[model samples]
Target: MGWNDMQPLLVQATQETLWMVGLAALATVLLGLPLGLLLALTRRGGLLANAPVNKLVGTVVNVGRSLPFVILIVAIIPFTRWVTGTTLGWQAATVPLAVGAIPFFARLVETAVADVDGGLIEAVQAMGGGAWTVVRKALLPEALPALISALTTTVIALIGYSAMAGTVGGGGLGTLAINYGYMRFETTFMWVIAAELVVLVTLVQLVGEGLARSLDHKRPAAASRWTFRRSVPTQTSAAPEAAETAAQETELTGSALR
Candidate 1:
């Protein structure tokens, strides 16, 4: 097909890729966050620590992460069929994309949550806050930026996975690249799809990084405000005592001189 003829196809394919990646990323986050939190909390000495449960979940996540995307797509064909009622198209493609991404996202969440200050958890507990409260207030809030970053990574990975899904009749930019660009010897079409994918992934990363930076920027300001509030009372309390002591010393000196 000529470039003009291929324009509509390219636009449609871009939309398909975006739709698949966006939905899959959303699903991954919804399912992965709690699962990852469970992993973090169930680990030894965690708020809801249960060693056995942690190990079991860790193992499952690991196994899922270990599979190659293409292999995962093939391996989960039956589940994909069951979920989408057909093992083809962008919708069916999302099943594997989401499935593959959940474990990966969970692991990222685990890492992000694990990095949260243990002291924060302890302080929350000391306040009589329960596990859920700590998780909601401390863990999730503290890990928000990192989780955004993880979602960004998962979305990029899903884009690649969706393209790979094209090989298995999963349609998207990948199908466009393969069917029109690669197989049909249309180099220009292939490059166009490739460029679009690059642009898409780039936009995703930029947005993710921007959000993370914005969140991170707020944290230091908040910490500084808290520190300032905490220190003001100490400084104020000391001023009166210091002034009184100095006055007392002056009085003693004047009396001695007389």
Candidate 2:
């Protein structure tokens, strides 16, 4: 078929691919982000350390990551069908795509969050901040750039997974390529589809890079270490004690010199 004939097909297929990848990415974030945070926080010495929970969560994430997308989609066919009421089309494809990617994204999130400087957490805690407060103010803000990069990686992976979804009647460019290019021996279709995918991935990568770079403003090395107010408490309840301690220290130093 000529470009005139294929134009509509290409547009529709592209739309479907975007829909699948976008929705899956959203779901991956909704579920994956918290799972990742939990994994990071529940580890030994973390803000909310729990050895048992950490091991269980880690194992589950590992198992989920072990399954390849192709097999994962097939393996979870029943669950997908149950979720979306059909195992065909881009909508249905999102179920498995999100499920497959959640663990992957979560792991990346854990890595990113884990890399945040421990001093920031300590600083927050010294200010009388709880785990939730530290997570919100310290960990997330500091790790945001790396998290964006991780999300970029996950979205790119979803694009590939979307292509694989096409083989199973999950409609997208993958379906078009397989149905027309490979199955029907239309070499032109194969080339065109491949080109489209390349362009799409390139655009995603470029945007992701821009965002990551823009947010990577965290200070380098020792500068990133926030000076924790360990001796003087900042809260209203602790102010009196901090003043008393300061006065006592000053008096001791003068007495020693005299």
Candidate 3:
């Protein structure tokens, strides 16, 4: 086929890929964030520390993560159809993408949240902060950097999953690549799709890295500023010390006057 003929096909494939990936990322974040928090908080010695719930959530995450993507795509077809009302197309593809991504994202989240300082949580508790407040003030903020990195990893992973979805007629760039490059022996078409996928992956990685860096509170400048500020006494503290010294001096002067 001529370049002119291939342009529209390529465009459609690209859009489909974007749709699959974008929707999957959204779903993964929404579902995975809570699941990850639950995993972190319910584990042994965690704030909420429920053995049974932790075990159950951990088991489910492990089992889901263990399954290969293609198998997962097939395994969840029934549920996908039930939830999405169809067994094929972009929407149907989301079901498996989400199902596959949730556990992966959750594990990442668990790691991120777990990396938060236990001391911070203790401080919050000492201040009478509840679980939600602790999570909001301590865990999430502390873990924001890792969580952003995890999101980047998750998006890249979803791109790979989108390719796999093509096998089931989900019709993305992967499907185009397979159909033209493999079946029809169109090397140019195949290369085009492959290059596109590479570029897409690269872009995702770059954006993810940038976001992770931006969200990271551990950067040298921020850390240095925190250290400097902490080393200095606050005005509130210095003011009281100054007032007490002045009061003592005044008392001495009064005694001398008498």
Candidate 1 local lDDT, residue 57: 94
In the predicted model 3, the residue pairs found to clash are none
lDDT of 1 at 253: 27
Superposition-based RMSD of candidate 2 using all C-alpha atoms, in angstroms: 17.1
* TM-score computed on alpha carbons, candidate 1: 0.83
Measured with C-alpha atoms, the lDDT of residue 221 in candidate 2 is 23
lDDT of 2 by residue, 160-239 (tens): 88998899899999999999999999889889999999999867755664465456665352132221232123234335
User: Can you write out model 1's per-residue Cα lDDT over 168-231, one digit (the tens) per residue?
Assistant: 7788899988998889999988988899888887677566655554565444543332433443
Off by over 4 Å in 3: 222-258
| Model 3 CA RMSD to the hidden true structure, in angstroms | 18.6
Query: Candidate 1: which stretches are off by over 4 Å?
Result: 218-258
Give the candidate order by descending lDDT.
Answer: 2, 3, 1
How much is 5 displaced in model 1, in angstroms? 1.1
